[model samples]
Target: MKTYIYKIAALIVIATALHSCEDAIDLEPISDIGADGFYANADQVNLGIIGAYNSLQEKQFDEWVVTELRSDNTQLSFDNSQNANVPYRQLDQFVSNPLNEFTSSYWRASYKTIGLSNHVIEAIDVVEDATLAAQYEGEARFLRGHSLFNLVRLYGGVFIVTETVDASQARNLERKSIEEAYTVIIEDLEFAYNNLPDSYGSDQAGRATKWAAGLELGKALLTLGTSDSKVRAEIVLRDVVSSSGGRLLDNYEDVFDTNNEMNDEIFFAVRYQSGLVGLGAPFANLFSPRASENSVVFGGGDEFNVPTEGMESLYAANDPRAGVNFSTSWVDNVGNTNFERFISKYNSDFGNVDDAPNDWVISRYADAVLLLAETINENSGPTTEAVDLLNLVKNRANQPDAVATDVDTFFEFKLALEEERRKEFAFENHRWFDLVRNNRAVTVMNNHFATDFQYNDPDAPFFNTAPIQQFQTLLPIPQYEIDLNPSVAQNVGY
Candidate 1:
């Protein structure tokens, strides 16, 4: 079991204490002295902030599946239909309904975080210590930004709740436009960028920092896709790349090694630890190969987020990361060679399927560098600088450098960078957002559906016969949410 530095006990206690209220009004703080008496001092304010961070842990399970499985990079795999997990498969095939469990959980958990952050932000002023108050406010804003960013990216317009609200208020609220929601997300991230510290000690290692906020702010701006926003994103990204003290690990495999987790390369991640009561991830059982002979997770694989063979083929013949990322074959308990490809990026020896210590990475230095390259390429045609930035990530995997001089047009340069990003971050839950951010989601995914079905089907006739409907791009607001709140409306074509 890996030993994580952060004290997860506090997060667990806070999560349990607030579980009932979280399910009630999405999330509301549970206080011994009630909301009026809560946030009376620095300690209480910090506890409130911790309550917000716990939502991230709650959201991580669906977040990974939503971003990666919906894209071409991964699929839910099992030998038989009986073993198939439909909640994920429905999403994978773009036939998901508004009542899909994972989608519903994502919505509820995201708003839960936002609600807790609002509580902290609204109450932090009462603290007597100025420095402590600012810190709490900064952390709350960072989390609020994080929640809204994820929400807005998935569902275009969303309900923007900046202050704590009652059930009646929530039920009566209207959805904000994408532009309006982004405005608040940007403002919160800007506050966090300016107010947060550069780094924290070992005890507080998982908390937000200035560089984390800056990276997120830059990402948020780039998502806008405006020329001015891209230019501004470049400025923020350049500072993060040049001065944040974050760097790519020399060995590509080391990035996922629990021993080397939270390395200089990682800007922010949801921390986890094994050997604790309630602090371990489930990726081991979720991604492991489905084999009855295996010892872990009761000798069967849940088989979620399994990588596609096409994704495996994208890497160069010499790419070292492929070995660490995927298991093309595994030895069974009886020592038979079973050739079944499965995701291995989060693979580690664990006590059970439910208890994995691997931390889920949110952002890293390489993501910033790639986005900087994207912004640079968008602002101007392919430049030597842009190619060099792509090469930095490529070189770490011992891959050959990209030849950008021959790439004469902006579109061609973008395709090159897209290929690099797809290979670099295949199973890391960045592919869907990358395709959407570059405006290639429909075309790329449409073509992918054709090829993927043909590849997965025993007969070629299935290819292109089952196409994803265009309106399936953005997920529908959960039906439960709409039933709970009268003012909310579902996404078009749901």
Candidate 2:
């Protein structure tokens, strides 16, 4: 996973703000005490970088923006009720809603981080050390790119702003075309890739590395090509050749283990300490069930996002990952060992504590490998090499090898691969995107949900029963963005 530096950046900002404001008589203007003035020394520059990293915390703005609203996972049931609190469940063609709290929080949080990244990037150039300046700049770019990628994927075409704007002006910012938005994202990743160090040492162990930028760039290219055939061939070639350094780990599950952040497979990750002073934890409380003894005493036990039956069935029977990813049967709060199923990969013995110290992986080598295989299959067909790569992941999951014989006949293999990804990466936020990319969402979801699935068939079965429309594939532009920016048009049918 790519190590995110924004968390560090956020901490620096808070510290700087506190120190600078300690004396009321120090009459320096706020703009005069800008990042350039503040980052004049190495220690200050380091703090600035740390502040950037701090922005990644859930409270600061990264979690809900990137993960909660994303399509990858859904909330589990609350007290045996089938419906979860996630509002988008209704938007997903399975339920109904007037926008739930999760969706609203996610939108607000994403734009907040975007604003923070813009502020940091605009101020960092004042540092005296050339190398330090480059590092901070690269970190800022990575954060901006990372945030924008989520925005585009979720909203389709989002406003692209490079500098901080007042609330009034921000509201008026127009949405860019998807192509235009991707162009900026590609550029930011490329800049970060060129300027970032190949590796971050002990002090910067979890910071973004060159490989993280490469992975994001490659994925962005893949997204672009998927939407535009004219750019497809070159983008795939570029991605495969440019990202050779990123290789899958020997084991699939190892990538998610708390101790695996330093593994070669990680490209970028959001760092969370067990009890860092300014740093906040997001996953620690969410993963543990209410009854677990280790659960955090205060805000723990919600288990808001639970894996669904469809997600569970995606794994082959007896696959090792099945047990690791979720627990169909576990000892309940009373030590009865109830056989209830819930997401287990994120479970930590820490119980309901808010700071269990598991870092969220944004990108991993396994995804790179699977992407390489899928790209090869899409562009040329299943080859010996592609099959070998595909099986490398499957074999790790302790499942049967893929039986795909030719590239043209690899659709089943692709389906299987998608299913494997759903199981392997459940709750990490990859499912909805996978369905969209493969164009299997409507059909697969209809069958899975037992509703009539049709793209635009008014007479289609379950038209009333299943309220899904094709346009639901792309989420509605947040109503806030529509209200703020007149140039920002809503998605079709919204």
Candidate 3:
């Protein structure tokens, strides 16, 4: 990673805003007085926006775990005796509680990000340079929309805070309708797509770009699910695919190498540095099997989200990503061989057990292209255009082409696209959302539970499985937040 990436972490302190009352769910206690006088110069505004970017890292791990573990891609890796890790087990089992700490922490982290981005967006008008002000606003709005998009998808409707607010105002705020929240998300992303630059110089890499907004906007619109919105998504995503000047890497493994941090395929990534500066990403350390348990895997981790047998079975024997994404067997440091599966995609030897500098890519060109294929198929059933797009990804992975002849109907094409996405993006925090978006979360999970539930131990308490209720798709509102503000209502069946 470059030095400027670390600068993002260093500038977060300047952007932390302190609110008067600490208990308000919408109010952040960190002071934003810096925003008052901090927008006078372009350099200061740039630093402030970097601070807002750093906020994304605050919830990255929880976001991935919540999305991935809750879906079919993975299962909780803790032993039956490990009571300390029960919250994660509950999440994997679809019985997460309102009091789960991961739920509350992720919710608070998201709000904190929204608060910081609001500070930047609120102060941008003071910037004298018109071009710089527009750019800053675009960046801030993109960040804010990105945060809100994640929130709505995870919890349904949530408090839509666009501007900085005092303690009293925060106390009175309530959750907006899902449509209302998405309306704001679209508006912000539209402004971002229009104003953000198409690309940046080397020193300014990893910053949000016009294509980032376009891709995210397309995803948000697709999530909203209307004929017009899906059409619009196809158009926006097609533009990103054609003009973004990015493509699938020749080798899929190169895309994940720690030395190749921001490759051509990456549209945006959370930047990190691995040394003693304390800014490296923790995925490597946390994803690796515990050092004492499997030293050959390199690095130490609690091994929270191990890949499931179903996930392992998704790929063909010749698929290159299969080898890079996980390990079915490995030799321990002590020369004993083990057959347990573990995620190997983020492995990096650069940092210590606590920190590894592997950058977590949030979006990439292949993902956007695959999404484009989906939207195209959704708009018009089983077109060659969509088949070609899917094949492009398969070709890059050295896998056989998906026979379009077999996909004669819209329903069949949808299933094929879903499986491609599942295999392409497994363990990258996209499985749960993919299942939900396709309206298959309930059916797929219930079916998976019928046969694969209690995969580690067939006699475990939830050994058989319960049907996933429709309302359970949206997580319960954290009990801590509801207690703080009685104005907020909990999601049904909490």
Top-scoring candidate (lDDT): 3
Error of 3 at 2 (Å): 2.9
The collision pairs in model 3 are 17-30, 17-31, 17-32, 18-29, 18-30, 18-31, 19-29
- Residues 8-124, candidate 2: write the lDDT tens digits: 455545555632212111112124455455556656556655655565564233243234323434433434333444353344344432244444455555554555566557666
Question: Candidate 1: where are CA atoms >4 Å away?
Answer: 1-9, 12-16, 19-25, 31-33, 82-84, 292-299, 453-465
* Local accuracy of candidate 3 as per-residue lDDT tens digits, 27-52: 45346544575556677667668777
Q: Write the per-residue lDDT of candidate 1 for residues 1-494, one digit (tens) a residue.
A: 33343445656546555644432347555544555576676776777777677668788878877789888888777453723577887787787898898888888888888888988888887888777677779889999998999888998898898987766676777889999998999999989988888887766777888889999999999998888888989999999999999999898888889888778988888877765456677777778776634543433677777787787688877898888778777777777877777887876666755677788888899999998998898888688898899889989989878765645578888888888888877688888988888888888877887777533476433222356666777888888667877567789998
What is the alpha-carbon lDDT of model 3 when measured against the actual structure? 0.80
Q: What is each predicted model's overall lDDT from 0 to 1?
A: 0.79, 0.60, 0.80
Best by TM-score: 3
What is the TM-score of each predicted model, taking all chains together? 0.94, 0.81, 0.95
Candidate 2: where are CA atoms >4 Å away?
A: 1-12, 15-45, 59-75, 78-99, 226-247, 276-280, 290-300, 406-410, 451-467, 484-487
- Cα displacement (angstroms), candidate 2, residue 171, comes to 2.9
**Candidate 2 displacement at residue 247 in angstroms:** 4.5
| Order of models, best lDDT first | 3, 1, 2
